[model samples]
Target: MTVGYILGYDPDTLREIVDPEQCAERLDEIGEQRSLPALLERVWLLKVLGRLDEALVLAEQAVRVARMGGTRKDLLRARVLHATILQNRGAFAAAIQELTTCAEEAEGQNWPLLAAFAYQHRGKVSYDAEDFVTARTDFKRALFLRQEGGAPEDQLESTLLAVDAAERRSRSSIAS
Candidate 1:
């Protein structure tokens, strides 16, 4: 699980995980030890395997488990995962709603990292909806917040999304 968390955040590292199938099997074996994190790993692995339905279920479970005595921060992550699953399923409104909740919570708690993550995901949702203007705003906010408290990868990813949003805006303007 330790290794999984370390590798899971970076797609490059996540892709390099030796034998994902074997890793999944091993995770299941020891999952009973620490259920929440284990469940989250399963969620991510299933998502990586393109099993969105299964990942969604596991993400819901993770959120439920988090609600049971988990910290607010933990619940935030679980909600974020849930929001991500919803987004993948094409439920953009619900996903955005969840992300909005995450953003509010993060802002209330003054957690810049979580706020940036929420904004980034919101930007993704907006981008998916082709609301490039809104996406650009969200991505810009995410980039700024990440610059303050997040990893460089966060800023880079948000910047990429921002670029996409800019291109989209330019294309739309051209069509006008």
Candidate 2:
């Protein structure tokens, strides 16, 4: 949730919409820079809607905007979102590379939350690619970081993901 941005519209209202396109369209119409958060949200929906090309476009724009005037942590979060789009697109190698860079940068800058988020995303990509061992390690580190940072909400989410990764690792181990 370190997305470093916010939407103009209410969250529950948007989630209630059956079609992501409608939400994305409404967000796009805002046309203001403050709408960057909305744009990023649309990018996520576009990915879920299988509009890969548009998702990439918006994700790139997000990164650019973040770099232009955002804080260091903002840039880090934006890069994480960009890597997330790549991850969803099945570009696991590229996603891993991007997340690794983000993780290193965040850690160096003393932004443990962002670093943990990057690790979590990389864990997801590795899990999707069936690299269970790496996934487990990544998730374990992510959970530890989240807990150490005392972000209860983030720790909860990461904990669930870590549990899933752990199960996958167990099954993979049995199979191997």
Candidate 3:
């Protein structure tokens, strides 16, 4: 799988019911690579496979590696992924706090794509926390950033879907 696929927060993928056997197969295919990118990929895969403990450890290592040697973009990306592991582990406050910092850094750097990625994930974390209003706001920001940055069709579509989902949920919550 591509790095984008591994690192991205794809609602479609999350919505699907993963098979344990297939997860095991995918884990085996990943084997024992030790590169920074490989660690990040492993973090993503482990998170997807419901191995949050392992994912968190790898995610921390990835962040440390990126901070020490990788480029600014790499460090931001690693931090975003690390925050996602926190989100998956139900650390909503911590995840939101980190993502907010990541988003601000990306915006200050004028990296629209990175900003969009951070906002998009922050939106997901907010959604999981049942903060639909905040989720909608963050998703809309992500959509605008993606559009301005000319993100890929899939990324744009994903943001669009997230916005729609958040809007619907927000409305339902208000009606209740």
Cα lDDT tens digits, model 3, 52-156, are 999999999999999888999999999999999999889999999999999999999999999999999999999999888999899899999999999988778
Prediction 1 global C-alpha lDDT: 0.73
By TM-score, how accurate is candidate 3?
0.89
* Per-candidate local distance difference test: 0.73, 0.71, 0.85
In the range 1-176, model 1's lDDT, one tens digit per residue, is 33433332332111223456765676577565447777777776666556789789889889999999689998998898788788778899999999999988998899988888798888777776767677778877777777788566735663664656556674786699
Give the better candidate number (1 or 2) by lDDT: 1
TM-scores of all models?
0.76, 0.76, 0.89
Per-residue lDDT of model 2, residues 58-174, tens digit only: 889988887887788877877888888898788999999999999999889887778888998887788778677787788788887788777667354645556565566658678
RMSD of 1: 4.5
- Pairs that collide, model 1: none
lDDT-better candidate, 1 vs 3 = 3
Q: Locate the minimum summed-lDDT window of 10 residues in model 1.
A: 7-16
